[model samples]
Target: MIRLLLVVAALFGATGVMAQDFPNKSITVVVPVPPGGVVDLAGRLAAEALAGELKSSVVVDNKAGASANIGATYVAQAKPDGYTLLASYSLYHEVNPLLFNNLKWRPESFVPIGRVVVTPSVVVVHPSLPVHSLKEFVDYVKKNPGAVSFASQGTGSVAHLGSELLKQDTGIEMVHVPYKGSGPAMQDLVAGRVQFFITAPPAVMGYVQQGRLRALAIAGSERHPMLPEVPTSVEQGFPNFQLNPWVGLFAPADTPDAVVRKLAAALEKGLTQPKAIESAKAAGASVSFQSPQELAKTVAQGRAYWAALVKAANIKIE
Candidate 1:
């Protein structure tokens, strides 16, 4: 029994030393989307900020495909050491598994480190659309039923899901147009090929300000500071119609608790820096930090929420 006790103590001591000496080399953060998108921007910003806090080199790797499964799967299968991490949006954790059938990695395959930023989706209509508000847009869609269409980044993306949720809530029937990426979707929307799109502010804010797309209402609990003039979906008569997209950091499951905590501390500190905050704001996002425990709860809630949304809306990917 004494030998067993001594062995356990030695193991614990080794773990402590490993945690103290964690991340001695450069760390790689994987973003499961193409560059120039919101997720990529967030990952690069976090990596740049975290490098300073951790006193180690940090780089971003974009693995854009299969609705983030490709990159997430890579990270999920990576070593549990504090070197390889995932910086992705909520869809991979909350919606993809529920929407796809043959996923190599499950949501539980990764452990949450913390949230980097949370931004609400904005409802933007092409300048040619004959609507000025959410109520008017709904009425217009109802009147013109199949004539109206909306664009989404991809079939199972948050933008797609958000539009699906809106259709269910408002009983509107509009054609769903899926694009390869947000850039293409935004281009089509601007060209008036699609009537409306509900996407992140950073994706559409410049267009809205430039008089290309008209802002109607934000799909969040409250209005964003960047578009204070626009009202929220709640204020527009759709209570509880908020869909805030969030970016978070994660490591493969079974990572050492001490190492996870250390990384989380660096992340929280790095994300709160003025430069980081400014970068997020410029991207139409807010720097929102949560502890590892809090992030786990958020992920759980998101999974439950999206599962129900997908079921009720009968949302599927083809």
Candidate 2:
């Protein structure tokens, strides 16, 4: 019994030492989407901020595939030693498990480090759409029914689900066009191949400013700083119409509490830095840091609400 106690004490001591020396080497923040999108931008920003705070090398690895399942599984299977972390969001953390059958990771697979940023989404229409606001868009879609088509980053993405929620709320029918990535979807939307898209400001604000696309409405309670002229969906009377994609940091579950606290503290402090805040805002997101417990609760509540939406929408992925 004494020998067993000694072994346990040594194990705890080692963990303490490891946590104290946490991230002594390079750290990788795995992003589950392709490069060039706002999420990737957020991940890169997080890496830079963390590198400053931790005083070590922090890099991003884009393992984009399978609707964020690839990178999520990779992170889930990574060593719970705080070196291999995930720069992920609602889709990977909360929604994918509901959408993917035989999903390898669960909500518990990740230890929530902290939320990095939250970017409010907006609705943009092609120049030819003839809709200038959310109400007009809804009315036009209802009038056209299956004739009008909408673009999504992918079938299971927040864009897709948010569109579905819009359809359910307003009883509008539009054909769904899912793309391989947000880049392709934006490309087609800009080309008028798809009539509409719902995405972040960084992705669509340039088009809106250039008059290439019409900004219908920001989908949250508050209007975006980048597009202050655009009114929110709530102002248009559809208070339920909202989709803000938030990115958060996570490590594999079973990561030591000491390491988790250290990383979370760095993230919290990093977010307060003027550089981090400005960079995030420049990328069309705001630096909104949530503690692990707060993030965990948000994830759980989001999962529940989204699961019901999925069921009601009868959304399926082949």
Candidate 3:
């Protein structure tokens, strides 16, 4: 009986050590949005880059629904191994908790790997609208009241909250028009179906450049790199109004320190690659890599900031 017990213990110990050997097989990346979107594109780009660095297959799995809560919750409940990772935007970690009261996992449940880029949302209006700048836009909304309808990516999405933040700051009433995604929202904005849309740069940059939509302001403390001529909401008289929706990588909490460090380093290295830089730029994002500690601090601050806004505005998911 003593000999049998010793053999069983040895087998269990061996199993534990084998489990620690991460990436022995393909790594699965859970992309919490549908295909062809900016989030999906970023995940694919990162996965391909990381796979090349690690010399292993990195598969991107699209798990779309519930504004990313479905995929995020899956990662939160997954085992703390480096094999499974979540490729999500800032909305998943920082903004959703304020909108989604039924979310099963909080921001604290995941471990930060690092960030990819900070994508700034542009405050845009249809070309037909009389407003040219953010101040003029606010004045127009104030004069028109509920006549100005603002299109958003979806209910409780960053675009939605961004518009809400503007409302809170300017004290203007604009009817909320929620679309299935940013693509559709921008479509309506270009067609003048909606007078205004607070959307990400990638979705609206083309139209703004083509004169189909007019970019009134960038939603951040300073001007966006791509739209340097445009002023920020803060500069347009709404001081302290800044919203930057970022994309980040995360592993389940309690992942090995070595694995986390390895992934973070790889991500940092990947950002400097020409392809990564080009892809980010094409998506209207600026590449800014952070270490795990720095990422954690940013995540914490973002959560608190968005949560405070949600509370003050009495915002809720619909």
Candidate 4:
């Protein structure tokens, strides 16, 4: 018993030493999407904020492609030291694993640090579509079947899952049209190439505000502060249908717990800065932070939720 206690104490002492000597150099933040997009913008904001808080430079690298698997797999396989972190969505860690049969990394390959934001997807339609509300959209889709088309940034993306959830809830049928990214999907939606899309508010805010697209409903339980006029899907009759394409930080699996805690603390401090708050506001996000454990729970719940959805809806990548 004495030897066992000694071993445990020695282990803790080593962990403490690791935490004390951590972050001796700059850290790299991997954004799994292309630059200039909403995810990239959020990552840059957090990186700048963390740099100040950690007293070390935090560099954001954009490695976008392959439904975000390229960057995700890169981070998952990186050294488990917390120096290389990923700023990505729930889809990459949760949904994609269920959608793709040959995902290189398992869902448990990364340790969730904490959530930075929860930006929900809004269900928007072309102005020409005869839908002024979620109910009307559902009714119209039912009547039109495959004639009504909805665009997504890519397969297995949150935008795709959001529409799939909508279809499961309302029993509506709409053809799926996948695009390279949200920009292209939004362009097609605006030009009438597709009638509806489940997209983040910032990606389509300009078109929605300019009257090119009509926002039928949001997937969040509460209306976004940026667009309070828009109602949530739950308010429109579907209950418990909340979907947020949130972006959060994660470290490679087996990363030192102390370093993960340190990053989480830095994230907490970063989210409180005035500059970070302004960035969140501009990005249509409510500045928020969570502890590493809280984030892990969120990830777990998200994985279970998406897995169930995929099973029930029979979603296939091909």
lDDT of 3 by residue, 1-318 (tens): 999999999977765675456568888889998887667877877787678777788999999888888999999999887888888798778888777777888888889888878788888898888888988988888998999899887766777788888888889999989898776777777788898887777676777788998999988887877778889888888775678778888999988777888778777887788988888888777777878899899988988877887888777766
Model 3 Cα shift for residue 245 (angstroms) = 0.7
lDDT of 2 at 197: 85
Clashing pairs in 4: none
The best candidate in terms of TM-score: 1
TM-score of 4: 0.93
Model 3 spans with C-alpha error above 4 angstroms: 1-21, 225-228
lDDT of each: 0.88, 0.88, 0.82, 0.84
Tell me model 1's lDDT, rounded to 2 decimals.
0.88
Candidate 2's TM-score: 0.93
The sequence of per-residue lDDT tens digits that candidate 1 reaches over residues 49-163 is 6798889999999998877899999999999987899997988778889978979888898998889988788999998878899999999999988888899888777778888
Question: How far is 234's C-alpha from truth in model 1 (Å)?
Answer: 1.6
- With a 3 Å backbone cut-off (N, CA, C), the pairs that clash in candidate 2 are none
Residue-level error in angstroms, candidate 1, position 135 = 1.1
Better candidate by TM-score, 2 or 3: 2
